[model samples]
Target chain A: MTEHPGADVVIEAQNLDLTFETNDGPVHALKDVSLTIDKGEFVSFIGPSGCGKTTFLRCIAALEQPTGGSLSVNGMTPDEARRNRAYGYVFQAAGLYPWRTIARNIKLPLEIMGYSRSEQEERVNNVLQLVDLEGFGGKYPWQLSGGMQQRASIARALAFDADILLMDEPFGALDEIVRDHLNEQLLALWARTEKTIGFVTHSIPEAVYLSTKIVVMSPRPGRITDVIDSPLPKERPLDIRDTPEFIEVAHRVREGLRAGHSE
Target chain B: MKQVLAVLTVVAVIIAFWYAASVPMNIRGVLVEAERAGEVVDPPKAADRRQIDEFELILDNPFAIDDTWEQERPRLPAPHQVAEELWDTTVEKKITSKRSLVYHAWVTLSATLLGFAFGTGLGILLAVGIVHSKVMDMSVMPWAIVSQTIPIIALAPMIIVVLYSVGVQGIIPKAVISAYLSFFPVVVGMVKGLRSPDMMQLDLLRTYGASKAQGFWKLRLPASMPYLFASLKIGIAASLVGAIVGELPTGAVAGLGARLLAGSYYGQTVQIWSALFGAAILAACLVGLLGLIERAVLKRMGMA
Candidate 1:
């Protein structure tokens, strides 16, 4: 059983090491990685490309087993937790099936999880409403804009009622204007759902905008260098990032990344 | 309009050549009958006013009899003669008559459908096995290709004999032979289709933490429909060939193949031509039916 949120830890890792045995030689993907994510807390992992942030995300999702180390999600192993439908994952790309309409795709998890027909329909409608895509349920994935596709993917994950969201570069494929709009909408959703999110990205501002705590990672060694807590208020929007308080936290995250670069 | 006229002209020239080629005098014949042990195996039948061979055209001079001695070339038979014969053999006499195309066609159709179903089922099952297991990928796939390369005619006699000795008779043996030859395309096509989900789509499923079976059912199967249907078209054609070959080896009592055998023995050129056309039409109709089913199912799945 997963320990409650107030029990002080929902995710904990100790001395996590991952290695890949390829033809070239032994490639170290992650080393001495350790972290914690409190329940209902929003955290973003940002670093240079090939920094093993995705590896770490996948390790937590049980898609990849670490070469060595102990990792736990709400006390259970990632695999066990996953079997229990514990986390909802959003990928770097929208990854929507072109053949399926928005409503049907959102119903995918519900089908696998064996929801009743009425419940499946209800949850799909609810999530579509949540993502501001209520009227667009019947539209095919290709018919929608890139941002809309991403939102549909989010709604798919959100529809399943999982408390944790593992978003790997969810808005990485969208343009700046759309990205900004989605970031604000995401923050609003986060505030409403209070999901414990693990977001991976390369954009510094994006990490700062959504994160309660920003984990700065560096490549080569591929380990976390710093975890900077945000001082900004919980109620945030695009304008919040322009404020003095937000800039200060952003500056600290930058320093943490710089420190990672130096060390 | 000009294109239509050109096409008609081409058809007319072809027909004229065909008429000249069928002139009786040009035909070479030796005995055209066989007898063994003083038994009449196939006796020469009574010749009508016209013989099919090249000499009959000059002898009869049916065309321009009273006029210019210009005989209209003797036709192989007007197409209507063959059609009337076919209708008489199939619909008029039905299966009870000795010269029934209906009985023979039924025999062939039954085998083709049985074999097609078996082959389709086997192919789908093998494709699933390949998609799921590394052992099958390494083992079953290589052998399947080699199996196709062996001349099916050589293989048919062996298949028929072996199955018959084992007490497997009638349609099942023939169908199994058909299936054996027909399944390879479906297996290859479906395997490719199942593997069609690339790294990006897989990564998406991974992010969702979908189980292996879930990934297959939700993504792989749906993605494979177009490939499966395309393969079905080829697979169905091969199945018909397999069934006909199966019938040939068995010295089939009733089938289009049997008609060919009977026609050859009796020197009935029209019978051979008509039976071949019937088989061709049957194969086309079966393929068309599968296509209709494919379109309907894919549309329902929203994959059209």
Candidate 2:
């Protein structure tokens, strides 16, 4: 694992730390977080709330700056990588502009990046189809259901086609059935696109099912507790969760979370 | 259909009240004229009649009650008298004549519209500045609020005088006053609108490395449409009032304000009522026009 070439490393964080200075005092949002995400790897940061999982993802996206240590994305500082449009970050909420149609909302980043009118239209159509929302582009955000809105938001992030995708609890608001369906769809998407993905969530099954690796973290000066490389096969079916290997990984993640809480 | 009926019912009630009140308001004039014609009176002297209750006088001289609404000049003009004067000035008289309410309304409307355009443009510009810069946010907002504290009536004559001394006259002076009255609402509403985008929305733009201009045109400006329209409705009404007030102190002869002044000077209560109605109608039409535009724009944007 250590012999992997430098060029394959999409994201590398070295002992990253972030402390928020609020009126109450200091909050240790993240501490001593270290990880490397390789090209085309689906990495999940799974932990309970305030475990610095979202904060870590935000640091990689340069939305939040680390107070200590160094982090790099695509071999550049997060800020530089951000300026180069290195990744697309999806928020917890769909956050689609009410005034923009689904197609137009997806076209927002493209418009900012100065894509030509024809190219914008083409890319919007492509992402719409990619997310299985092809016929619904002309509808407004409010016209769509919650699950569909989240899917449309995914399509929006995918519109710019950056090599990396960072999603912070994208399906946290969804129901279990919708979440399972979306999880399956997301695995299929990751397989097809071959993009490095950093996903933040607290659901053990979701993390175990979707990720090539699971980084378990703990709160109280938040830090990583475990890094588990899945032994499951690359082409995973939804029923794979019932398999022994998937269940073993899920058990390990639970154990790691329990250990973090007990300490 | 229900809304129209509701509005008509309210208007009918108001007219009924106006007609009932006009009896007492105009009875003294009717009694004096009746005495001049040698009609029988219970109270022999005008001074004695003044001491009697107006309704009691109406009961004693039932025949004179019919003359109250038809008086040439009364303390309070009856609803029908004002309506008749409005119809005569607007429809019966030629539009180009001095007696035509339409010509006067047009003069006031032009200034109101011109002032509204200037006010809206300046307001939006100031709002954009306030949103983008900390200095403007802290400095300009307080001043905008302070500007509103000074009554437009107190400020209007000074503005007219200041502009006139500098060789600016006619519609420009009135438009300036209108603009003054209208801009504050736009500035406040637009500032709120431009800042309406949540942190997550702004962060999404930041992820794309969107420039300030892009963030504004793509997010802030579009989000502000509903607020802008609301402010514009208020601003337009204020603009009309400013234009009319601007005419008052200047003694301008062409606008609704001038008509009001002339009517008061000559004790033409019907003319004054008609001018008041004309100003109100103009304000309603302007606000209604803005409402139509707001609905159309928001519908196209799918925010309606």
Candidate 3:
């Protein structure tokens, strides 16, 4: 499970340094944090609270500009990548427009990107079916359960088929049963679509359950502690979590997470 | 039993006082006839027995249209009399009839709707400007609040007079007045509504590479629907006020306000009351109609 140099690189962060000039003082969120994600790779950023996992995701999405060092996505600077619409971002919260129905919510990104009306309709329908929300297209966001709402948000991200998918703990608010269910569905979707995914999460098992490559991070000037590569096979079935290799990777992730939290 | 009798007695005593108070007023008119009939009458003050005259008139049914002393003694016609007058003049008469309340109401309604439209449009436009530019926000927001503080009643006449000087008569001046008063609420409401999206949502749009205009059209405008409609309801009410005020200042001869004035001139209390009520009903209907439109638009947008 060592680094595959021949893998297709989608994003490369070189000596990244992100500092915030708050009223208190200069607070460094990310110090010389560097990583490379391959095309079609399922990468997870897992760490203790306040470890800048969300911040790194935001910076990669071009929602926040990195203060120092170069961060590139799809061979362009993050800002250029943003202008090129190279990524789809799903925030921790569903962030669904309450006024919009499930189908229309999914179509929001496509609409903003100015897809033709027919294209928008086609993409919306496809994504809605992908999320298993085919019959709930006309239902409002408020009317759906929290899990369904989150799935709709995922559908929204998937609608545009961007090169990179940036997810900030997309299921941080869902219950455990629903979380497990979605995790399997997500892995299945990723396997089918072959899209590069960058997920941020705080849970060790959840991280181990989904990630092909897990970047373990620590707080206090957030830096990567250990990069855990899963040898548990890329084709993740729900029963894979019960396999010896999957359990071994999960234990390694937990140990790395513990060390990261302690220090 | 004693307390009940005492309460009844007190009520009787108040009635007696009320009857006594009207005696002088009735006698002043009634004694002129007694003197003409060569009755051995006392002085005007002593013969001023309005209570006795009222008692006799009530007992004999004064409005019975008898040959002897045929006259209706109406200090103030009762509620039923006013209703009858209103029905005869407004509903019973044709819509084109001058005395018809419906015609007057229509005139006032047209002015109100025109003013409301003008006001709401100006309000939304101003709100967009204020939301987009800080310079306009600082310069116009203060003036908007100050303008409303000037009292629409005070400004309505001036608006009419100025518009008249420029040969802008009919409903235009009234609509302008309505718009002036109504736009403030819309501006305020829209500004708050347009700014409702949080930083994350804005960043989401930014990451999507949406330009400012695109972001507004796709995100900001849809988000502001609830606030916009809420403010519109208030603006429409203000528009009605502006129209009514507009009519008061101008010599609007065919509107509800004109009817109010004509009724005042002749001391026709019932006419004035009826016109006021009709104007209220018209305003309510106009506001309700706008609400229905708002509901329809929200439904189409899937917001409600």
Superposed model 3: Cα runs more than 4 Å off: A1-4, A98-101, A138-143, A239-263, B1-82
Q: lDDT tens digits, residues A27-81, model 3?
A: 8888889898899989999988878888899999887778888898988888888
Which CAPRI tier for candidate 3? medium
- lDDT tens digits, residues B66-132, model 1? 2211122222543444666678877888596667877777788899888988998999999999999
Complex DockQ per candidate: 0.28, 0.91, 0.52
lDDT by residue (A46-137, candidate 1, tens digit) is 99887789999989889889999999987799988887777888988887886689999998878877899999999999998888998999
TM-score, predicted candidate 1 vs. hidden true structure = 0.80
Per-candidate TM vs. native? 0.80, 0.97, 0.82
Error of 1 at B107 (Å): 2.1
Candidate 2, residues B1-304, lDDT tens digits: the string is 9999999999999889989999998888999988988988768689999899999999988888889989999889988889899999999999999889999999999999999999999999999999999999999989999999998889998998999899999899999989998998999899999999999999999999999999999999999999999999999999999999999998768899999999999999999999999999999999999999999999999998
Best by TM-score: 2
lDDT of each: 0.81, 0.93, 0.81
Tens digit of lDDT per residue, candidate 2, span A45-123? 9988999999999999999999999998998999999888889999999999999999999999999998999999999
Candidate 2 local distance difference test against the native: 0.93
Candidate 3: tens digits of C-alpha lDDT, residues B1-304: 9999999999788655644544433443445455565654444343454445545543443322121221124333333445576787787989898889988877877887888888888888998899899999999999999998897788788888888999999989888988897888899999999999998888877877878898788788888888999898898888877777788877658788878887777776667767876777777887788799999998887666
